[model samples]
Target: MSAGDLPDPAEMTDQLLDEDTVRQVLTEGTLEISGRLTDASNLTLLAVSSLDGVELECVYKPIRGERPLWDFPDGTLAHREVAARRIAEYAQWDCVPLTIMRGGPYGNGMVQRWIEQPDDSPDLVDLVPAKKIPRGWLPIMRAVDTGGADVAVVHADEDKLKLLAGFDVVVNNADRKGSHILTTAAGGVLGVDHGLCFHTDDKLRTVLWGWAGESLPDSVVEGLARLATGMAGDLRLEMDEYLTVTEIDTLARRIDYLQMSPLYPMPPRGRSAIPWPPL
Candidate 1:
């Protein structure tokens, strides 16, 4: 199926298109670059793929367009993005959208199905007046806005975001800014921009620290158990396609630690625990 055959994201209650269909359309369909996301750190293009009279809107991040990073090796960000989705899927979480590594007009890159949020959707994470913290919202920290007004960085205490936070821990996501969380009209929550994940070291910076030091819910513990079990099977082999052997081993260890501890991790000591521009 091509992009044209997919239902409009807003009109769908669940996933607009199934993962397998998206994979086929993105891999085999013809791609046309329609626009660019200028705010992204890397070269991110907005594009459409067409195949068999179907069309789907997707984000294209070509490997050649990836910017050099001091910590990450050059040209591997797109691979990491695809790997993140695989890891999340393995953990039995659908928080990451369908992503595939494919050749595009810009050569080899990562292509992910675009998630459309409704216009009236509330921010899953945001900076709000310190005193006006919404009931049930969890405050992560306090800071000043551009006008020097007191503002608190906060996120919802919802299960969808909690699951994503757990997935971030397993992948060692180095950047989990508030804006990375996408809430759909269908009530599905997903995360994007995962090129900075799956690092070999402990770099789990994120805005979802409200659960820090709390015992992980049974659901999260179960997901960790699933991941721990997969480390010895095809999961490791699948991850090896995108991450180095060392990184894969480290990921396994992270899963083991979480299963043993079963608690949300505390912010790392002696390093920033939150990404810059937290929102």
Candidate 2:
């Protein structure tokens, strides 16, 4: 049903929306007539809100509306999006954003709460003027900017990025481009666009190789351990909703490996380690 066709449930606008409220608005809200996010690739991106009264801004990517991909099974990318968020939540790495797979104006797809972008926040993938990397940042790639001068694309080595880096490892994210990391208005970082993930094989392409082989700080290890237990136990059952049995088993193995080893993994030698257009 079109979102405009439904009734608004509450008079919520710019109010802090809890998970339940967000989910309800997404599941039952009316879609804006021109809600589609045109710049989105590989699928339609719809902006929607609950008809009941809450004006929640949300991005909806419907499963059936996806463009075909040779590598992934049809209509399954939306589930993987949800699965990535689940893993992120389990590890306490809230960077993945709150996501729900529910019926929308088009069909069943993934709905994520829109994060407000703050003008003052630093860009995750930004160019620097100097040759030397900054104290708390790492250079991922380099190139010239529009001014025909030297510039380097870098990421800050903050806890927010670190949490996302760890989360990406367990999910085997294949498209961790700089564009995928978003900065919230509150100066926090969050990772998005996780459809290309959770393959049984090792497909961890990303721009986050700055800390490869470094020890995952103790806090990171604790978070990983907590997730490992859940992945092996009840989480495995939930994983079935989005992942194949082989993929779930491999995720469990990754969790175990991360907990025991307690180090960032080395990039495998035989493959391209980072994504194209690193910024």
Candidate 3:
């Protein structure tokens, strides 16, 4: 199913999407995969209609419905999705959309609460005249046309987007494409499609390099510290259930490194740091 099949988000909603209610629905809800979203990877991206005690819209990815990846093991992407959200939640970065793994029409899979981003929100990256940038927006880079006219690529300096930058680092997210950043009428930024994350190796490919060398905010550092300190407790246990022991250890190591530095790390030399077709 395409985005056109979902409810419009331009209109505001005062009624919160209750997490507890959503959890119940995602866990026990009846699923309807009426069609497939075509612009996805080898897997079928399903627009699902969920019904437990109430009706809701969601996206479902059944494990048995995916194509194999050489680097990633089969049937583990669902766990990675939930694990990524868990790590983000633990850090109090609510950038990730609410997600859970559950049994579905095909088999156990990942189901994410669909984020109805308001269409009016500005693109995460947009061209702006160099001197006309609004206050609180960050200038990404300057580009000059063949005719020598200059423009700046700018991003909204929203706290949620900054938090998501750090969140991607901690999760080692490998596929944070521009299309994954969802914005709400209330200016909430929710990240989705987190199936390639938390691998043992460094694989942080993302479009969120706007704050590449900036200092981490005090609150963001505090959150990473909390995650680092809790590695021996419930965090380790929860991750162990899905990720390999090596990957879990690597996550703790990454958190430790984040806590040790105040500045966001620079991209490695000779490495392709940003994801392709960056917005």
Runs off by more than 4 Å, candidate 1: 1-15
Report residue 199 deviation for candidate 1 (angstroms): 1.3
Candidate 3 has an lDDT of: 0.76
lDDT tens digits by residue: candidate 2, 70-151: 7777788889999999988877776887888887667788888787776676776666875876878888667777888788
Report lDDT (CA) for all predictions.
Answer: 0.88, 0.78, 0.76
**Model 1 agreement with the true structure over 107-141: per-residue lDDT tens digits:** 99999988888998889898889999999999999
- CA RMSD, predictions in order: 2.9, 3.8, 5.6
Per-residue lDDT of model 3, residues 50-144, tens digit only: 54235566788888877778878887888898898888888887788778888877878888877776768768766678888878777755678
Residue 56 shift from truth in candidate 3, angstroms: 1.3
- Model 1 scores a C-alpha lDDT of 0.88
Q: Candidate 1 vs candidate 2: which has greater TM-score?
A: 1
| lDDT of the structure predicted as candidate 2 | 0.78
TM-scores for candidates 1 onward, in order: 0.93, 0.88, 0.84
Superposed Cα deviation of residue 49, candidate 3 (Å): 4.8
Mark the 10 consecutive residues where model 1 has the least summed lDDT. 7-16
